[model samples]
Structure formats: C-alpha cells, structure tokens
Target chain A: MSTAQRRLDIEEVGDVTVARFIDKKILDETNIQIIGNQMFGLVDEDGRKRIVLDFTNVEYLSSAALGKLITMDKKVKAAKGKLRLCCIRPEIYEVFEITRLNKIFDIKKTQEEALEGF
Target chain B: MRAGLVEVGSLVPFQLKRWDPQPCGEPRRPAEPEKSPLEFAQEMTDREQFEIFIPSETAAGQAVQDRIIQRLEARGFTDRDVFGIRLSLEEALVNAIKHGNGMDPSKSVRVCCQIDTETVVVEIEDEGDGFQPEEVPDPTAEENLERPCGRGIMLMRAFMTRVEYSDHGKCVTLEKRRSVEGE
Candidate 1:
C-alpha cells in the first residue's frame, strides 16, 4: 500500500520512532491490517531500536488492534528493540488494564515520558 | 427476562430465547404476563430493535456496527457507553465473521440489536461449528499475555454487562446497561 493509505504518521526523534495513529477509531480490519504491516515494518524493515506509539488522537481501539500491538511488541523484542505506548485515553487504558496487558507493555502517560531514558 | 415483552425485530425465533445465565445459573426465560400482544408492543415503543444479516465479511460487520453506533447516539447513550459498546461490537462481530464463520464467504452472520433508554442488547449468530467459551485460554494469564489472539472474547466480557452464548456457541448475546451521566 502507498503512503496515502498509511494509517500511522511516523516521526523520528533521535534513535526512537514515534508513530502517531491517524485514525480516531482503530476498529476496521483492513485499516488494522495496514497498521500492523506498517508497525511491523518499523522494526522488521527500518530496523529501528526504540519506538513510541502515541495514541493521543485515538478515541476507540478494538481487540483486533490490540492483537497487532502485541505482535509489534514481540517483533521489537525479537529485534532487540524497545516499544512503549503513551497518551492512551482513559477508556482505552481501561481496556489494557482489563486484559492485564498493562503489566506486559511499557505504558507512559505522555509521549515525552515514553521517549525518555531510551 | 423482562416480562411480556416479545422481542420486536428478532429475525430468527432462536434470537428471542434469552441465553443469559441468571444468578442461580439457570437460563432465564421471559415470563408471560396477562397483558395482550398489543399492550406488550405498546410497552416496547420506547425501544428500538432491528436485525441485520450479512455475509461473513468484516466490511459487512463494520457497517452493522456503524448502524448500531448511530442508534446508540440517537438514544442518548453517553460517550463512555458508546465506547464500550463499540469496542464490544467490534470484538463480537469480528469473532463471528473471522472465527465463527472462519471467513468463509458462503457463510453468513446475523446481527440483532435492541436499544432503549437504559439498556442495549445485541446478538450475533454465525454459521459454523461452535466452540466452548471455557476452552478459550485466558488471555491475561502469565503464559498467554504476549499471545496475539484470544483477547476478543475477554474484551467483550469486560465491556458488556453480560455476555452469553447459545446454539452451541455459534450465537453470542452482548448486553450493556447504560450508566447514568452523574454516576
């Protein structure tokens, strides 16, 4: 898919790649698939070491999206990289809390915090 | 089950059967009341109920979800309620389409939604061999936390007030009682 169909806005801060999701609702399967491919490419293709996913614009996230994030985390780990998530809204955080994913993923309150100590 | 209320727009007769387990662990059935059918229908005027049948395609599921969200917004459900419902709907519908029907284009999924001032009920049925919910490994377990799949059912149970399965698990019913604004 072309950049026009990209769902994530990628920005590099030093060695870390900060990806911001463009869609407020990450519920569609096709969009989620594209996002998964794009995110995986960050570690698999671009060979980035540190990454932060800023969910500042996201209002809704489905379990499918969470699945992709989990895969991304694994990919980053396999590549000897780090992944952090920040700026998730309260409701979405509750989703993480409910699934006990909060314990596995390094989540921060803001992008600044997620970008720190890398 | 609410007494004397015939489900307004359930396309399948089985959809009318309430599969939600009660506190006593029994399948709850709607109690018959002395009121006439017209009276029961009148009582349900405040509720909106509809059904959508779609091919086992994620796009069709998304359309149904969008329609349900529109209905929830029109019914004045709060943002929190909408978020939970939308998330649960996505999980449930995707499960029906992807897992239940196994993405077989020939298979179909049926979705039924009923919305009222204080509650929303949705049921999705798919054509496939059903599996036991208990058989699903807990996604939150330490051994499974990093696993990519199996969280959809967990999320649905978390977001919905009640999650029930019937017809050998081919059908799932999701219910959410709207939270009062001040609460």
Candidate 2:
C-alpha cells in the first residue's frame, strides 16, 4: 500500500523501519484492517527485517487492532526478524499490561532506544 | 414492537421495546422527554442519555460509538476515562456485531448509554444466540498471552468499574465512575 493510503508514517532509522501510526484512535475496524495489511506488507512483501512501531500518535486502540499487532509480531518472528514498540502513551501501555502483551513484545521508551541494538 | 425497555442504569438484562426502525436504518435516538426550561437548563450538562439501535455492521456501529464518546467529552470525562470507555465500547460493540450477531444484516444491536456527573453507564445487547462468557480462555495465561482474540473481555474488565453480562451473555453492561483529581 502507498504511504498515503497506509495509516502509518514510515521512516527508516539506520536498518530499522520505524512505522508510526497516523490515527489517534485505532478503533474503527476498516482502518484497523487497512493498517494491519500495510504493516504486514512491510515484512511479507517488502522483506524489511528490523521493525519498530511508534505509537506516539495513537490515543485509543481496540482489541482488534491489538490482534493485528500480534499477527505482525508472529510474522516478524517467522521471518527471523525483530520487532520493537515505542512511544506508547501510559494509557495504551496499561492496555498492553492488562492483556499481558507487555511480556510478549519488546517495548522501549523512545524511538532512539528502539532503534538501538537492531 | 416489543414494549420492554432496556434501562441503561440497570445491571439486569432487559429486552428492548421495539420501535419503528429509523429511516435508512440509521441509529435511532430516543426522543427527549418534556422538561421545563429551568429543569432543562439545570440538567443540561449534568446528564446525557441516548438509546440507539444499529444494524450489525462495524461501520454502522461507529456512529453510535462516536456519539457516546462525544457525550463523555461534553460532560467533562477525564481523558483516561474516555480512553477506556472508548476502548471498551469498541470491543463490546464488535463482540455484538461480529460474534453475537455474526454480522447478519437482519440482526441489530442496541446500545443504551447514560452519562452523568459521577458515572457513565452503557448497555449493549444483540439479537442472536448468546454464548457463555466462561467458555472464553484466559488470554493472560502464559500459553495464551500471544493470542489476540480473547483479550477484549479482559481489557473491558480492567478498564471499567463494573462489567456484567446477562441474558446468556447477549447483553453486556459497562459502568465507570468518573476519576477524581487525586484518587
């Protein structure tokens, strides 16, 4: 998907591809579906290995969106790549904590930190 | 039209009293009750209420969700409160539209919400054969943490003050107390 059509603002820091979510509320199903496809295409199609998801723009996220992230995580792992998440606001971090996804994904406090060691 | 009204304040499951579907199948907003000017002014910002029925499509569901979020913001719900409510509302509505009703256009979902100074209550009911909540696996378990599907119920429980399922899980009632400044 083109950057205009994708819900993410994609950037590259060194070898890591930093994809920032553009939507503050990632609740709508259609948007989530589009976002998921775009994110998945980075690995399945683009074959980019090191990935960092920047959540600085996201204010609200639903479980369906999280499902997409989980699938993305699995895809990255299957491709023998790495994925890191950064800039998640406290409320969203609490969501990760509540669902115990905090344990499954490597989370960082900043984009600089997420890009390191990748 | 079924005459049984589903009250938003109640935890018990209540059947919706059927009314004529709104034109174009838009979400039906309940008519405002008659109130004197003074009473209306006094209660204008103190409480907000809506009773909506939408078809079983996620796109149709967004209108109902956006209205409730706007109501919460208008009533001065803290950002955190809105975040959780917004998340929970999405999960609940999707559960109703997808899991409960199977996205059957013939099925409908009812959302009744009441927002006041101290509390926000929302009741969502779907027209379908309900499932047992207990049958859902614990998503937080070590083996299940990576699973994406079952976390909605858990997040709703974590975010809301009270989450209750009734009428064989066809109806879910969500409540949240407004967060205090220091507490």
Candidate 3:
C-alpha cells in the first residue's frame, strides 16, 4: 500500500485518530529501523470515532512491526478506541492470516470506510 | 549440488539442498537427497565476517524474497529450498539487526552465508553489545509459551544444524553439515 521509506505520521478523521506508518519494513538492523512500539496514537476517549493505522505505504512488516501493532491495539482498546488498519498490502495481509492475527484485527479497505465503521 | 553461489544481502539461512523438502535444516540429509543444508563457514575472522549492508530499503517482502530467490535459483536453489532458507535467515537476521544493533537503520548488520563443497553456513553479526545466550528465555520451554523474544532463535536452531552465539553474544553462527552429490 505504501511506496517509500519506513515511517509513521498522525492524522484525525471525523473524531478518529489515524497513525500512518510508511510501508517500509522496520528491520532489526539495516534496511530499516524500529523507533519503538508506541509509534501509533493513543486516544483517551471513546466516541463514534476510531484509531486507524494507515498501512497505505507499508509494504513489508516483520514480527517487530507486528508487535508494535499489537501493543498499539492494546492501548487503543484501553482508551475505548477501535484499532483499524487501512490500506494493508496483500503480501503483508498473507502474513497476518498465516500468523492467524487476521482474526484479531479490524482490517479495512479505506480510511473513510473505517471511520464510517464507527 | 554443483558449483553454485547465492546471496541474501546475503541471507543467513543458506538452505543448501538438491531435492528434499525439509532438506536444508535436517541434521541427516542424504547426499543430494530430495534436498540438503550444507554449511561452509570459517571462524578465524572476527564477528564482522557475519555482517551485510543493504543501501536501498524496500518494504515489499515478496520483492525482497524474490531478489534473493532469483539469485539463488540461478544457482540451482528451488522454491522449497528458498522457503526454508528464508525462514531461518529471516529469524537470524532479524535478531542480529534488532537485538544486536538496536534497530538502527544507519548501522548495517553483517551476514555471511556459505554454501560450498559440503555445508551451508550462516553467520550473523551486529554492531551492538551481545547478551549471554543463557540469559535469553527459551520459547520452547513451558515457561515461555507466550513470550515472543526467543521464538526465532528456537526456530532457527530447529531449521539449522547448529546455532551458536559469539561476540559476547551479539554474533551468531548457524550451520548445517553439507552433503555431496550422489555420494
């Protein structure tokens, strides 16, 4: 979904919190880097809003990146916000399904749809 | 089984094979059976021998995998062989980069994959201080069922003949004995 370096950004959608991760795979060493797990946003309240992760640029994700998503999901749910993944790449989606994590996450085709979901 | 050379950046799990499915990692693969996991690593040099540097970063795992796969394929590596190698190498490289270098993209990680006359050898080194292998929790053990830190190590060990840590634990050397062609 993404087309550049591994990165993260923040945005707001209809009261929803969106954290955009550059599709760059955060390798343990070279090729990429992992800043930390809390790279995603943490909202403090629950409304007709959502906490979305824009995977539009993320092309490959390792377990480390997956770990960050898990940690972020926990924080989002704790704050009563839903963790929604947007524009996930098909290959990475294969990885998620292989790891059986597809069942635990809210994967959406677009940001607008995820926001509308709530 | 003949004169062949491949790289994984180069990848660590150099799954040496000729035919078998789980061929690369098995301890007792036949001489050019369905596959093989031959090793060819030397320990005279420092841990730096186990490092690598990839300049351009690509987020596409398939592309990354394809790059390595095609390189190996030209040298006679099959799809199954690549899969096993990818799994083991990914685990080792991931650890070497993350735990060893602390995930610093600026600092390159070292990886040495040797597929020579009789074995498949993979050595990985990071630019960070190493830990005592003993101190790391064992994922296969009952106590570490849910922890994710050491599962890769366990999996790597399973897929390779041996997994050893050095450079005070920051460098890892993985190997699988090589098999000859129809010996």
Q: List per-candidate RMSD values in Å.
A: 4.4, 8.1, 10.2
True contacts kept of each: 0.82, 0.90, 0.04
Off by over 4 Å in 2: A1-4, B1-45
Which stretches of model 3 miss by more than 4 angstroms? A1-6, A29-49, B1-90, B97-110, B115-183
lDDT score for residue A75 of model 1:
91
Per-residue alpha-carbon lDDT of candidate 2 for residues A14-48, written as tens digits (9 for 90 to 100): 78899999998888778898999999999999999
Candidates 1 and 3, the one with greater lDDT: 1
- Candidate 2 per-residue lDDT, tens place, B1-183, comes to 012222222322232343222222458786567876455445544555668889999988888888888988887888888889989999999999999999999989998887778888888999989989999999988998788688899999999998888879999989999997555
Per-candidate interface DockQ score: 0.81, 0.76, 0.11
**Model 1 segments more than 4 A misplaced:** B1-42
lDDT of 1 by residue, B1-183 (tens): 344343443422543464232333566766668878676566566766777789998899889999999988988888988899999999999989988999999999988887767798898999989989999999999999988888988988888899988888999989999998977
The lDDT-based order of candidates, best leading, equals 1, 2, 3
What is candidate 2's TM-score against the reference? Answer: 0.84
Q: Which of 2 and 3 is ahead in TM-score?
A: 2
Superposed on the true chain A, the predicted chain A of model 1 yields a TM-score of 0.96
In candidate 2, residue B94 scores what lDDT? 93
DockQ (model 1, Cα): 0.81
Residue-level lDDT of model 3, residues A9-115, one tens digit each, is: 76766677777875464444333334343353144322323677788876545555555566666666766767788788676676566555676688988888877
Lowest-sum lDDT 10-residue window in model 3 chain B: B42-51
